[model samples]
Target chain A: MIEANTPLLRMVRYFWPMVVLCIGLLIIVAAVDSTGDIILAQTLTEGLVRMVMVVALYMFIGNSGIISFGHIAFVLIGAYATAWQTCCPYTRDMFMPGLPTYLLNNSHHVVLAVFLAGLLAAFVALIAGFAIMRLSGIAASIGTFAFFMALYAAYGRWSTWTSGGSTVSPMEETTTPWSALAYAVVTIVAAFFYARSRWGLALRATRDDEIASKAAGVNVFGQRLLSFVITAFFCGMAGGLYAHFVAAITVDSFYLKMVFITLSMLVVGGMQSLTGAVVGVVVLSVVIDVLRRLEAGIGSFSLPTSSAEVGVGLIMLLILLFRPSGITGNAEIYWPFKGDISSSGAMKRQS
Target chain B: MDYAIQTIISALSLGSFYALGALGIGLLFSVLRLINFAHGDFITVGAYALIVPSSAVTATLLIGDFHPALLVLCIVGIVVMLAILSYFVVFQHAQKSSPATMMIISFALGYTLQNIIVMIYGGRPKAAGIWSDLTGQVQISSGVSVQLLQLVTIAVTWILLIALVLFLKRTRVGIQMRAAAEDFRMARMLGVNGKNVIALAFILSGGLAGIMSLLFVTQTGVLKFSMGVPIMLFFFIATVIGGMGSLVGSVVGGYSVGIVSVILSAILPEELRGFRDTCVFILVIIVLLARPQGLVLTKAAKERV
Candidate 1:
């Protein structure tokens, strides 16, 4: 009886895989860094940024059973927010003179700027989700997309702070592989905790059966909005990570391409679990990196430019066709030390 | 009044593209219960059929230089065939997937198709004018001066719209398609050939897209890989706002989008006009907030997994 699995232990069990995966990723990044593979390290760092982005995506999408294209908008806000805080005042003044007087005068520590960026993004998401969360199903999905388009259009043309359509470059590159991995790990932990939270349970219940959830007295809109804000915060932080990784930002970077890439990662990773989000980003990034290398000329074989996109799209289609739920089959990483799958299932069932 | 009439004339022409594209998308959505992002690429395919496939700077017309009737027929036939082929090749196997999965499949398929176009044609926008004379302006009435193509567009759209309505009301295959759209399982259990009806809807939509690409290319006078994307976006929005399941609603939604675009472009100051899409999308969000089922719905939108 003393050894029997408890809910608190089961929760910890659910949380461990992300920490393990992050450590594994950190080891890989360190090994690549030690080999002096600049390109490889940079690519892995970019992959880490995507990990944060996709996992952030999974928070709202996986738990709430809503597919959102708008989270990238939050990411865009974060990236720009990071840009404002970290840019050299002279360059920013010349390029983005529309920032507030304080933001114009001061440079923030990287950690504060990034977290504030997330907070800003989450605040914005709260407002957007308030307007959007009333609807259920497909309308909500399209509503999110509409929000994405609107934000993009506004940002693309609003030349005041963003420098409008031009790329803001050569500012800073504070997002190294180590930092990106840290962000990824943080996002995964945050998403895991949220998923295990009561709001996540209610949101997921609404996902499974909306009317039933309503009858069960769940505040469906509130739960969806809460998760939307939570994911938005993480995605915004990812934007900060991305901004510094490239040492640059553009409205286009956070456009349809990013939306598609991150959404595909979430969906391909199986959208139902934290592990799927991480796995999808890693798998897709590796595949993209390989294709890019091959396209750039790996000895005798060279593919056409943009072949990576086609290849990834084809691979996604094939994977989705074969396994509609995703590669993980919507399951988490099993507890390898013991046959804990049954016990975990039993605990969740009881909970 | 003259300025207003002039703007409306232009809006009517643009709206015609939305109407056709919306009809195509709406037809497919009804049958499949999912949006097909690749339908735009289907339009692109038909438009690209006008020229010899090449990576050259300027395009030389192939079937495009043929008699107008023959060219239209050829392109429509090609697109219809492509639509039917895509179903069998890609979507047929994906029928059991959720709406979200299916939408992603369509997005992936579109991405592949667009890249393939880039691979074949290169990314440069090539000048490909099928009918230069259509670009000429004509005096329509005492008040308004408009392009000849505008009049042609308005006339053709009304004709197509009426013809489509008649076909849906009177034809057996059309009725079967409608029945299947209403309730696929019930229709299948009854007498409708589900596969055939779905295929027919695809054909109708494909043919409509073909005609739209023609008009679109004629007006724009340039051919590019992503030529169909702008129209596809509007039509997709139209599918949602107008009503996913209702044909009339699709048309209404498409025209609404077109009119809004034109009006916004005209009204907004120069620096702010580029963000008209932002405004249009804001309206769409508001619309969804007010009416989650769309402005009109013959039936409730299908459940998403």
Candidate 2:
């Protein structure tokens, strides 16, 4: 084991190494689609945004040790929030015609718009969490799933507010490739920080033993609510970024399929570890990308493939049957290449 | 007044199916502490079984002339068998893991089964006939007509529920199942095979779902590919409101949801018709928060916090 003390040794733990790896991965992704062409850049941007979205989901599933099938609702909200801001007043007014004139005219500034969307998502979560976080285990899971279904029904029917599934367009003004990339990077960093924070530790403790945690004065309900709210914020942010990047939003994007995809990624990466989250996202993303390409290549030939649902279902089954605790199992990945130089002689001996 | 009677008949009929479905869910929860998310899918599976001609076996048993009851029993038998097989294969393995694992696996199984249904029979909805297309309407007064199927559904549901209660109370196996549900380890020590008991719970749940499907499709005259989610929600809400482990609670919960939905659909403004789901969810939330143990007798905790 590397000695705990020493200047150089301290600099190179699991945390910084993971950070470097993240940055390196980002650089590589940036290099692949750095060109300014709209279509190619858009695809690349979409992929990155998808990655961040999946990772944010991973953070929730990883840290909370509970299942959330309703998180996509927040994404839907964020997407609509951004869409409402970016689209021209006439278009927004045409879809959601009751908008006040001044409010419709003043919709600009993507940054503030996205932030507001996140806040709204969090607010919704706060209200929903009060109900959802009361139960534990499978009850909580079912409760959240029910909440999503209710919200889905409401969103579909609330035509006065969401314009009844009609595409609100011309959101192109709200997006810049650079901003999307920046958001993705910041989210990943934030996820990392949240994973190691005190709340994270308390959550793990709760997961490990709820009775003991309660005895230790940890309020299980409160912790779960806080975690859920944080997760909703990131999910909303991802949604806002996606809305701007895609130039539109639809209710379908936040359906059961999206929820399943996020759950599958969390399971594959190792539900218990941050490294597992990263790995799961990368692997699932690659699989999805390859499938898209293959489907495109096949063109007229329909492969009878049951969409992405099959992949997610298969992966979740395999992980549950094989690795119940997941790949990381509450441990962060430590690379040996980042040598322990703090003890001096040990580093020298290793070299 | 005619509309009121129609609505009441419709509500009671709908409640019958919901009661059957919720009982299935509640039984599994009580017996095994397993929330089979696939409970709704089992209902869908049963509907498909009734629809697909190739998978079905035709038999004519002449007691008087022909007994459709025997044929229905056969179909329910098939459903129970399939449910047993699925539980033995998927959930049995999850017995050693956390509750979350079982939930995920059940969900995965549900998804797979849904896709498989789509593959075998295309994603289009199928219409099932529990009763004949021939209609017998009770013309209560003038324009309002309550269909024969509505009455049949209510009768069948209550009969099945009575049978279930009798089976639970009167039979040795039923007693053992109940004992296992109360405390699996203690029941096991007393010589009840916990595994078999759990599997039995699943079989009973699936069989009930199949019966509900038959009644539901007969009433609606059409079944859709995506019918599982809404029905599942109905079952879940009923189970939650009535309490998970209590049979009487499941029945009460089903009636409560059916009555409330029917009332709301009628009295609710035209503009708020779409918000029926919102109301249902809000109601469930309020119920859960008020009585987390549910609206019945105190039982074991639903989930470990």
Candidate 3:
């Protein structure tokens, strides 16, 4: 069997398609980065950052088929953590007087702060996942939503550690299209490797048939918890990227609207494929950009404001109606015409 | 004591809205496996019905000028029509899709409805002047008082709940609905009309939403485009904690949340009061961990995933 090949051979074969895709994406981002238009740069950075989040979303949801509502919570935690580490030391102390003296006195490098932000979020996810992963089906989803709300509430009022509901600002503006592109590539690769891992396969099997997988020795809860934490780490880093890019942070930015927009991207892209995640982000980002332009009026033919959201809603409906499985229909865009070169192949979607 | 009675009345008053919302969402969910996220939109549209758009930026009383009963009836009728129209135009086409697809479709539909509301009423919260008489407070004993509207809310909610109970138990269509909720495909094979049952569910849910919105705006005295979001969140929590498909469970869960919220607000230090909802939701997660089937286990929910 093609899947029965040697380990090294299988790894190389799996690597073939993902590397090509990542390189292709990198080239596109580089071209966009070269455009030198500030608005285009802003949109490109936004799209790439979102791509990181959607990819993280795909890592867990694509494998487990659970639509998580709390990944954005990690983004929130990460941004705040990054804000703590990278905000101006004087303002940090003035605003967040509760931070330890060391953090209040010294600002860390932005890159290192980002990594620490991800670690903190991953740590929180690990603890939370233990309780959460025990639940299956809609209960698990609702559990995540609960976790999200709890975290948001706690942070919103932790006035000494945060600016409370106010914006956290005066730090860094380090995220560029190039840096965001790099993060997106790294996230995509991580998601690809994670999905191709034995743990990912075990999780997917549980998703497909939990009873059958349990009989076959899959630790369903553990697998789910693992994926959940991994997704949290990526989302945390994505949030870190977002904070540095915007040069400001606010708790509200990572709330319900962000949750819906990111989830919509994953669903529109198809929930089961890496290609779907990236493709969904790019397509929707471009559509939103166009709609935003239209809303601003391109030479007296302007549409109403907030019509972009309507356009997104409508496109999502049409996608769900015409392609219930999403634009990718649960299939990864592999190296085409090579005829199933690696294992995993096409997903046997029971949805 | 006066304190005890006041707390109970307040608890019931808040619980009424939650129970109504949970009933609608749970009913639709049981029959179709669709969470019907657009139910919130129905509530919002019903609230906005009191004041039709006078201009793009402002609204004036239209049918709200009618007698209170007729005004209420007119709002319920409009929401029901919206529900029926959505079923025909959107949900009917996606009948064969997955629960996830149906849920997403409902979300998008909700988004569309919210945008439409914003387009008509603008994003500001409007000071609605309906049932102003109910705003008056009622004194029961020394140091004991409650809003007259709160009592009316309790009365209206219970009356409606009783009516729904009777309808579900005694009517032919209601029995068909219960059968469909139990086992949709089997019920269909046994000659239950899937389309008709689903349509009836939408109607009942929409009417409940109408009533719930009325009670909601009457108490709050304000309406915003996104007002439904928070109400829907608690309704979702109630449905889940109550047990998704069980009617009594939904009502029980709603009251438990309401009572617990009031208790928490009363008991917690002022600093922690802001976290009352967070605390309730965390408790929900714990309950799920202990009983994923919910507080009231259902025969259908017992099927292991």
Candidate 4:
């Protein structure tokens, strides 16, 4: 256990494997795109999305031990913020009648706008955390869901500011194949730092037992709030990337369906481990895409055609029934850094 | 004066729907410690069953002129089928899981049921004759015309409430259910069949939801794929405000939510009407902060798990 938390242990964790995975995925993407196939490009896009989302899930639930139904709210806030800033000054001037004049004039520079979008999402989440983190257990879970509903209702009805639920599209700058790869790499690295941080340890202690942790002088509320804000930041970044990835966004894209899908990814990945989040998101997203393709073939074969949503739901149910603790439990796989160590020693050190 | 009476009458009719939904939810919560987010979908399934079969019967009558008695029997048959299906599939399965897991799974089941309905029938709203533009409203004064549907809704809900009270107090199974809900382990040690008692609770809750479905479809003359979600939220609020395990609490919670919503819409700006949900949540928070237990719980029942 002493060896596990050593600075040397931290330095090598994900250092080589992350680099290798990114390079491998990039080559695979490049090879497929070179074949002049649109499907290849689409697959690459899905790959990037899955990777980033998986990392975000790891940061939010895997590390923090808090289930959030409203993470999609940050996604919407970030997507719209970015789209509103990069779609062209004239287009913004015409459609968004009430946007600040400064924003209208600065509707270029996609990178800067996206950065701002992520920051804005983090700020909003910070505010929400103040009230919501006050709750614990089922009350906290219910409160967060209500937060999602409240935001959804507001986003739908307050259309004057958000073009009244119109799809914001044609952002001048878009995510290219290379940039998506870069974002994925950054996502994995950020997730590593987040999970190993002192704050992360505090959050985990709170999750295991609140009364004992409070007795140990941990600021339970502060740790939870900080984690919530950080998680929302990544979700916001993912939203920004998504906005630019497709050059279009809709309110419904960030609603309950997406929330459920995100949750399924996190759960299937293994709720307790970072590797599970990454594995679950990548595997499920690809599986879903493949199922969508099979829909047509299945229909021709006379089997009842099922939608992606149903397929995912079934997977979620099966996983729960069989492995309620999820695939990885709470263990993160850090290959090449597993110096000889006893498992019980690790457990004792954690306590 | 006429408009005032008409609005009050309409509100009261709508309040009955809220009351019915909340009452069932409250009953299940008292017994099972589960929220049954799928409860509203049960209502949706019941409405679809009643409306679809009744329409088929009405069309058959128009074509072959079937007996009116057969038509009535078919309607009853549809409602019974829906209630039984609700018990067998959702609530019964959910009883095995913990409260937290059940809440999540119930939500999953809800979306699954809703989407299956969409796949079969699409996302369009369906209505029945009771909610349709039937004529002949009784005018209490010059302009206060109350529709027959409104009267029927109120009368039926009141009768159901009375019968429910009598059944719970008088029946053997009902006594067993109350005993189990208070302390599951204790009741089991005393030889109560906990499984059978919980199953009965699901049946009663689902049946009450079925009755509400019939009334609501008639009153609004519309049913949409998404109506269940919002109504479910309001029902949850009602259950919480009324108290978790108290039958009377459910009734009071239902009426309170309905009346508060209507009054807020009337008094607040049109923009702020949406804030009523937020207000309800805030009210629950306040109740938790002050009492932790509900408004109407007994001393024995107040020590909630």
Give the candidate number with the greatest DockQ: 1
Q: What interface RMSD, in Å and to 1 decimal, does model 4 have?
A: 3.1
In model 1, pairs of residues that clash are none
lDDT of 2 by residue, A1-351 (tens): 454455655656535635764776677566655655665556556656666666677666666667777788888888787766766556677777655666567786878888888888989999999988987766677678778878877887878667776666667644554566677677777777776678876776777777999899888999889888987887887788888776766777678767777777777777766566666766777676665555455667644445455655777777788776665554455545545445333222110
Could you give the CAPRI-style class of model 3? medium
DockQ of all models, two decimals each: 0.74, 0.46, 0.62, 0.31
Clashing pairs in 3: none
**Ranking of all predicted structures according to DockQ, beginning with the best and ending with the worst:** 1, 3, 2, 4
Checking candidate 4 for backbone clashes, the offending pairs are: A159-A164, A269-A276
* Residue B197 lDDT (model 2): 81
Task: Kindly give the stretch of ten consecutive residues in candidate 3 chain B with the minimal lDDT sum.
Answer: B52-61
Model 3: CA > 4 A from native: A1-13, A337-351, B54-58
Task: List, residue by residue over B1-305, the lDDT tens digit for candidate 3.
Answer: 88889988998888887888888989888888787888888998998999877434445778767888899899999999999998888888888876666776888899888877776567778877777888999897879999999899889889999999999999999999989988888999999999999999999999999888888787787878888888888888888888888878788888877778888998999988877877987888988888777788667667644
Which scores higher on DockQ, 2 or 3? 3
Model 1: per-residue Cα lDDT over A189-229, one tens digit each? 78777777788889889989899999999999998988898
Tens digits of per-residue lDDT, candidate 4, B12-53, equal 766776788788877777777777787888777655654442
Q: Give a tens-digit lDDT track for model 2, residues B1-305.
A: 77788999999988887888889888887876666778888877766666543312331212212256865675577678778988877777777776666767777877877766665556665545455642478776788988888888889898888898899899988998888777777899999988778887887887898787666666665655556767887888998889877778888899888888999999999999989988898777677777776788634644434
- Interface RMSD, every prediction, one decimal place: 1.3, 2.1, 1.7, 3.1
Evaluated at residue A278, the lDDT of candidate 1 is: 83
Local accuracy of candidate 1 as per-residue lDDT tens digits, B1-305 = 99999998889877877878888988987877778888899999888899999888889999899999999999999999998988888888898877767887888888888888887888899888978899898887786778999889989999999999899989988888888888888899998888898788888988898898898889888888887776687888887888887788888888888888999999899988988998888888888877766777676364534
**For residues A1-351, could you state the per-residue lDDT of candidate 3 as single tens digits?**
444467865566657657766887888777876777889989989999999999999998889977788999999999998888998767777889999988888889988999999999999999999999888776777789889988997888888898889888877789988899889999998988888789989999998988999999999999999999999998999999999888878788888778878988988989888888888998899999999999899997998767888888888888887786678787765533333433445422323
Segments in model 2 whose C-alpha atoms lie over 4 Å from true places: A1-9, A34-47, A173-181, A291-302, A338-351, B51-74, B126-136, B140-144, B302-305
